[model samples]
Target: MKKLQILAGLYLLCSSSTWAVEPVVSAANIQEIRLSLDSVWVVLGGILVFFMQAGFALIESGSVRSKNTINVLMKNYMDACLGGLVFWLIGFGLMFGVNQTGWIGTSYFAPNEMDGWHWNLLFFQMMFAATATTIASGAMAERIHFVAYIVSAAVVSGLIYPIFGAWAWGSLFDGEGWLKALGFIDFAGSTVVHSIGGWVALAGIIVLGPRLGRFGRNGQVHYLAGHNLPLVALGGFILWLAWFGFNAASTVKAEVSIGRIALNTHLAACASAVVYMVYTLIRGKAILMRGTINASLGGLVAITAGCATMSPLFAVMSGAFAGILVSILPVLMEKLRLDDVVDAVTVHGFCGAWGTLAAGLFFEGRMFNSEIIAVQILGIMAAFIWGFGVAFIVFKVLDKVLGGLRVSKQHEQRGLDYTEHAELSYPEFQHDVTFETDDMTKRH
Candidate 1:
């Protein structure tokens, strides 16, 4: 009897202790679980976006001349590193800080916020800031001074990109900005990021002028072929993969709707590729690899603003239009005597505007109305004017202060790889390399 009582007492004690220390995980705790999941999803999404920096680097290096490959690679590296650091120090504060009379941000500079969700948001936005500045790299490639490029990258990430971002998405989580108050809807920054990058690229190119051999006498346009098509295609695929995170992660929550966002993004890209390829075939022309890649990217840009707002079918429609837009805009720019080295203006700028407008046309739960369309147009035009105008001033000022943005004739002929970095991308093939300078007889 004594042994039985002792054993029963010990069992009861242990059972009571277990019940007291551990709560049951059930439906009652779902809210907390959901919050944790949301944070995890957001962080993962941010990580995926960071991988796009590699994609940009590959695309840019492959698209330029072989002799300038190293220069392009270095510029891209600086864009992510310097841009991310500057964004963390000042850009994040200006973008997501407390509003100052609905104009700009005033707080969060050098942030020490420890909230997991807030940090996740910061990471995601930092990637976006880096991307915006990097877009200018391809446009100004081959001839720009490294120091000047760094300065321009800093300016865009620290001030121009963030301030505009504040006006549109500063209140993304639960705040309000002037544009948001005006009912502007940019689901994932088509107008805010890509269009801004595009406009800025245009400004820099205009200031820098055409590459030496790009235009011939009598207004003839010469085509400068990219060094590596395989790398370009590979880069495109990587960007396409990254975009799933870009569009889906914008939800900022782990929910079923994320599936829809990702699906829409995929559909849009596919439709765009098909349309571009068909358009080329119908015109009795061989489908160009670079054009198809750019068209796919244009489709991705177009769907970014409306991915969450439109049906999958509408996504297809939007992407088809973007494919057509990217195709024609390049020709239009060339006709104006503007040489955009990689067609960033058309793929990002023109398509970005169209994507924003397409959202107004197809958004669910919002009645098709002139007011919404007008607001969308207003935002697009605002981005174009501000992005282009400010970038122009910045470049022109840098040109004067830095003793001109383009390199000398001698350096240009020798290639930026040798002139700017004093390194060759392919040193083993030195004999095959061509130098256009009169000093060719001189020893290296």
Candidate 2:
């Protein structure tokens, strides 16, 4: 009986010890929990950013003539599809790969043994790559051949975009980069993504030239209005909604910083919109709807590079500055006879540059840093040179290889909807229509 009692006591003691230890083991690991939350937050943000493609499609299609609506939609769709496939295949490797000489990435191709966390990072970045490529679609719309656009999308996502991205944002996870060392801080890629995309768009529009009838023989510029204001407004709203994710979620972790970033983004966008409206009204002109939308977008772009670094007041100032640029830059481009279909250059390129500089100047408490601004300018110049210069050569080569980047005169007149795709956006309406000479519209 004594032996039996002793054995039972030993078993009971061992069971209690095991039960006590299990709770300690299961106690929340703060680091692991934080990482998991970050992953979920970033992935959700990526989905929101992904939806911006729809917004782009609506914006471009609504802005262009109805005859070319289907063509613009296809280009937007292709931007996402081609960007995803190519970025997964090579861009991710190039952007976040092992650093080689601090210029570009060298690793992360599919089928490799990568951590799950790295894959999550890649998914988030793929959306950014797609967005960079899609921005050019609006500028090059109505004129670019489908095949040529495909090539452009592939090259931008696979090479041009990734290479520049590596220069600035490659160190997001690990490894040092030259740009970061030079104190070029783009918190969320105003120059890295927007400027690069904008420069590429600029190159494309320059190469493709103004759409037919956009300018007259006497050097008069004509206005080409979008087909639907309501659709344009919808697109703008969608973009504004997604931008919260774009800026706040860029924090990569659920923290107090996210709220600040969100607030800054919202304030900047609102300030830009209100300022643009007032600016236009003061110029003895009615509030321009397109100007308002572009101003909001420009403000968002402006804040992206500095969203994390700037306070809300500074963010508003940056956005207001961007709003001014958005309102005036397009007009200046038109005066120069440079036709940008949707002011992609003004909103993304110019405002993106300003935003980068603003971040350097208004870096929270720092207020003024000449060194930082110099670095910012260096980044901006590099982006323009690399993005615009490479795209120019690529488009030039593609033009020769594909016979031309622009559609035949006949196709442009008839509209790319019928020429590029046999389907029409509104098949019920007569497809055999041409733009009205008095107004930029199609009539049977």
Candidate 3:
């Protein structure tokens, strides 16, 4: 009886071991299992987000005149392909695979040559590099040369983007970088990536000036309406879908994965679409889907930096407010005589800042041992300064050396397809292609 009791006690102890902090199971096997599962999902997310590039190309092309469709398509394709190469060679090292320095990431080329997590980190960051490059394409659409754009993509992804990303993330220092000390926390990069892209778009627009005949002699704005609404809405939806990857992937840990991240992202996006539609209805642009789409994008951008730190309720509120900003900011930009073809700056830039700041106002918990309000502000300011400064210089240099950023007014009227590509976007409409020396649409 005594021997049997002792044996039973031993069995009980062994069973309870399962609940202990340390596991008797092999750690190596567990690590491999975790890596295999996480990597597949992460890459799949990237693939979905990559599809957004296609959506962007189609929407951008369809919205513009038939003459500019092929031009826009080429830019989008080139940015992703070449942008990948650039990020692979240099940008990844600077953004994530570096030595964790604050000023700039130390590695410039071949960051994944080292063993361990280097390769996965590089792959994830490469996607963001492509995204940043494409943002500029939309802003500079209808005129930027393919050759010039290729160079810009290389420089932006390989150098410009990586440096800023390093600064924004705590990778700037082993302990506390300036922004880290300030308590700035961008969960995913509303300010760091999208806002920076927006700032660059602003600079490009300023340097390139308005599209030819976009404004009248009396300083009146002209209407350069997009050719297709369906395509625009499709692009917006694709972007919304990809956003799940963009925000959720920011957690960067198997342990951190939770329902909170996804719920916050979805709620914010929903609130944004509704709010923008309502705001635009009140503003009298209710008939147009462009406002609704852009507003949703704005909401997504606004929630990016705050998503992980905010509750679902606050995220929805923040997104609704951002939708209003997205709906109205473009009109304001038009009033100031800036011709942003796809509303890239308003959607990415304006909303990025708002989203970053919203975290400060609405953040309810601590996720990374940082203060939400201060960190959010610092991140926004950092993005604005770095993005605006570098973009201004790049635009100025390109404009000066390239002999004006836009084509001659005569070429603008002739259609970029014939002048730049020596081809027509749609051969069926070639016979009716009308060339003019002035704006085709009436002034607004």
lDDT of 3 by residue, 1-444 (tens): 999999999888878957567656698988888987677666766776677787778668767877777778888888888889878877766665445435655643665345555455566677777887788788878776667667777888887788777676635214333565456767787887789888888888888888876889788998788777787888888888888888887665544654688788888888988987776678776446777777778888889988887888899998998888877788799889999998989988888899888877876754334456656766777788888888888777877888766777766776676666666677577545745323333211
Q: Where does candidate 1 stray beyond 4 Å?
A: 1-23, 26-29, 172-175, 431-444
Q: TM-score for each prediction?
A: 0.91, 0.91, 0.87
After TM-score superposition, the amount by which residue 369's alpha carbon in candidate 1 deviates from its true location, in angstroms, is 1.6
Provide the lDDT at 305 for model 3.
Answer: 86
What TM-score does model 1 achieve against the real structure?
0.91
Clashing pairs in 2: 97-107
Model 3 residue runs over 4 Å out of place are: 1-25, 97-101, 170-178, 254-258, 366-372, 432-444
lDDT of each: 0.86, 0.87, 0.76
**Candidate 2 residues 1-444, lDDT tens each?**
999999999889978856565444434687688888889999998998898998888888889988899999999998999889999999988888888578887767652677777766788889999889999999988888999999999999999999998888784455756787788879888998899999999999989999999999998999887787788889999988988888888887788899889888988888899999989988988888888999999999999999999888899999999988987888889888998888999988999999899989999777787888889889998999999999999999999999999999998988888777765677667344743243323322
Q: Give the lowest summed-lDDT range of ten residues in model 2.
A: 435-444
Residue 383, candidate 2: how far off, in angstroms? 0.8
**Best to worst by lDDT, what's the order?**
2, 1, 3
Write one digit per residue (lDDT tens) for candidate 1, span 339-377.
777788888888999999999988887747789999999
